[model samples]
Target: MNNRKEKTFSEVWGEFITSQTAKGVADITIRNYHQVLHNISKYLDIEMTLDNLSKSKFDEMIVEMRKVGIAHNSIATYVRVVRTFLHWCKAENIIFIELPNIIERETVKETYTDEELELLLRRPEADCSFCEYRNWVIVNFLLNSGCRAATVRNIQNRDVSLADSQVIFRHTKNGKIQVIPLCSRMVNVLRGYMAVRGGVAEDYLFCDQYGGMLSHNALRLAIGRYNKSRGVAKTGIHLFRHTFARKYLVDCGGNAFTLQKLLGHSTLTMTKRYCAIFDADIAKNYDNVSPLAQLYHPKEKIKKQSRAS
Candidate 1:
């Protein structure tokens, strides 16, 4: 029997890529996997075969990445991609080596405060220009709906129903359709934008000057310019999504499962992290509302003499 363990890492990776493509994975995701694998191959500095891919080798790679000042999140991504490839190899009967499964990820708190969100919402001055109006509508819509940048970009005029107070997100990150209800404020904003947008042949609700679909870069640049003007740091387009999630949890009493569906997450893990962050905020005020703390002291005094008798 030909030993499958003799297969080179590159050969296994090529097969994995073919499998991923056949599975209909997104092009960008495939590219990311390929890039990470290539980086791993370079870092190992050896002709890595399936048999040589030990847990220690993976650990060494991670240590080297960290030593080079790679960010924790980036290193975590690398570890995840590598582990996935290794598991694929095992499933394909390419290697039987036990692989380490755990990859520590940094707890990144990347969300806007209420004040920052307020500032962002009111950033655009009252101008009648298409650019000004479109930016305002996009910002508000993102905050209200918690839809991703890609989902926002793909929204069509027909997808929104002002009468129903809902908008359907057809092209989501996870390939699952999400229907988000429109708040009254968001509904009013959309109506105003549509009026200024007028009846156009373009299908997309938000479009460029030439009536073309709005690109991700355009949205990024718009947000970037706004951030620059206001001197806001760590404010990206995705911050709006984070703000929406946090606000939904606090203001609307939303739970992890509901947030998972709203955010179109494939799993509840990411949504749970949002819950944790929200819980932390709640913890900060726990002292004032602690049941025991409030019950221990009473505002009204009973008649002590009657109790003694």
Candidate 2:
């Protein structure tokens, strides 16, 4: 008789989380795993033994989610996370269920126009409050670097080296350090802000009014309020990243390879989306570089005539 013990789904999930934590996975990612499983439990028995798990049960749970009005994109996200967990289970020889295909649709990414950017970039008056001034600087940083809000929140004063014309992102999505150049213009702006903000090297670069580290929601709310005050309606802080990517590719003609590194994407998959979305950028000066357009520049215009015969 076979003597291997069968592990319950909950036991396996707890083990996976522990393993992932040991691998230094981000806390947010771990939290997402917990949340997704909890939501899945709403539709079916999430604590059943690994042997009872099957793709049919997953499909039924998905149907339940749809009936209850979960966004498709959000459902897609849950599928992705759960797939990772199932893959881990397979690797550990705990259980195996044929995974379903992940069908996700690409949505258009919105970016700020030059006019909107100009409005957000406007400098505050000399007597502006610290929060106002800080928000302005934060907007500038986002536009300049295209960093995520979490990365922005984790910045330390020492991470920015104005004299060296560089900024170091120590807390990236992939948990790696990313260093990017700081333009002289941005250097000057940060220099002025830091002088006024004044704190030790260990202080958060963009701290709360109380000189404490800024939280994620606080950062988003600050940007939202700042945008409304400046008369710009769109308030998604992540749009700054999208805007930066668009401007970097469409306006500045930056290539994808460098942008991939600049954006700290672990792969070209996401970067290629930006390229495909902004593919029209290739036609911006097509006439200037077209081989036929340049080659057809004869000394005299050529015209077609009736057959000589």
Candidate 3:
């Protein structure tokens, strides 16, 4: 008998993504894919072989994930990953099955109410340290610039052009470069940060105490520490980005396409998600206009004729 074939779709997909992800995907995202694939393979009893995977097997994987209490959103991510890989397999002339439908993603916009943001910004904890300052800057950067956390992690010293009042983001996930104009306050704050924590010319703007680049985990830990020290509710950085996008769209009437480009989203649908995030503001504006304000009152002549009759 011929020896069993050893190749698998999962193996091939992992290799392909590892080789090609550098061009369009961020380093952190590639790492995430590796972890996602690893866990998925372990969940299935059989090794992740190309010959064994089918639409029915994919369906079973989702059911298993749900049984284990994985959140629907997380399951959605797993489905997307498998779908993308399988589609690539089909394109590459490998084994193909009926493509599985993607798990529907729910839209939940987490935002800070204006009052809450004002309170957080105004009052730093009494026991605040450098970490509070770091959190403040991170929040300010995300809210003011609408930059993603990934871009924030990769922000380098050279990317900032203080004289021109612009920051260059080169390594965005969307494969486009953007120059974001900075307001005076942001420039001043950034200048202060740079002066206090100096790093090598090529190093990131946000660095550890030892002047090394700050990793995502370090930033997250710092934020956590700051939240604890300040006695504030825990919140992630993306909330700031959402706050920025919603406020900009509602108050400034920022164009959807422009906002999408600035946010480095690959599609308008992602930007449109933020439109709902500003629904309260939209409702307020709508309330200001009423048909009662323009409705014509009955004429005095008609009233006089009715009185005469």
Candidate 4:
């Protein structure tokens, strides 16, 4: 055959990985993919060239991955990314092996228990005057809005639209500006904090003593220390978010699609994980529509059918 542009599988895969790494995917994601490919490459006993890889090799690699305690979720992510690259290779007529067949991943639930949430929200503030007040406001806002830590850290005074009773998330994980309704408590806190904050200070709502934007790490550490001092466990900003989601879904009887939209998740499937973790009573509450209670003298279904016949 004439010379073709069919490239080696290994070569294309390497290039694809490099390109994806440059696109701002998380460091953990990059490392996991690299490690998975490296292990697969080693198991084939040879170069494990993409053109030479077979179904048997893929199966052995998966078994080894399981033996090493890699989570199914992680493996599923790897399969997705790898398959995307391999499909591209196939389009170019360069595939020697098909992508590994993996089961659909079960979602991992990460919601906080009520006790953990109460501990996080009630973590005592430091004796610092202004800092303590600001942190209280921060905790309250996080509990009410379910905003991510990054979004909470980046809140500017202008982001709060008091007239509309809304707060805009400027830099969400998906880069969407999500506008959440400001709870009355949040509005009151914001008003009080702003009354103390001078109008001339042109920066974030919560700033360091130096009048700069708040450091995400410092905020995290402060919250952690506060929790430690109170002898409460599991103190993280994410826990606040988890608490907010669970409480709102359970206590307020909110729907999944609405929660998904409010939280700015890209998919309903992502929000379903939170729903799945909720107590059975919470899920049942949403389904409790009693026709029997509404109808005092309802006709029996079998009797009604017999009478009609």
**lDDT for each of the candidates?**
0.75, 0.85, 0.71, 0.68
Give lDDT tens digits, candidate 1, residues 233-287. Answer: 7548887887788777766667767788888787898677543465654765576
Residue pairs in clash, model 3: none
lDDT of 3 by residue, 131-163 (tens): 566677777777778887778888889998878
> Clashes in model 1: which pairs?
none
Sort by lDDT, top down from the best: 2, 1, 3, 4
**Cα TM-score of candidate 4:** 0.66
Candidate 1 TM-score, true structure as reference: 0.79
For candidate 2, lDDT tens digit of each residue in 1-309?
111125677777888999999998976688888888788889878677767778998899889999999988788888888889888877877667766756767766888889998999989999999999999999999988998888999999999999899999999889889998887889999999999999999999999999999987799899999999999999999899988887888788887788899999888887766434556567778888889998986677687888988
lDDT for model 1 comes to 0.75
In candidate 2, what residue range of length 10 has the lowest lDDT sum? Answer: 1-10
- Model 2 scores a TM of 0.83
TM-score of each model, in listed order? 0.79, 0.83, 0.81, 0.66
Query: Candidate 4's residue-wise lDDT over 183-292, tens digit each?
Result: 78778878877777644434787776666777667888877766675566666878777767777777777777788988888998777764454554344644346565
Clashes of each: 0, 0, 0, 0
Clashing pairs in 2: none
Count of clashes in candidate 1: 0
Model 3's TM-score against the true structure = 0.81
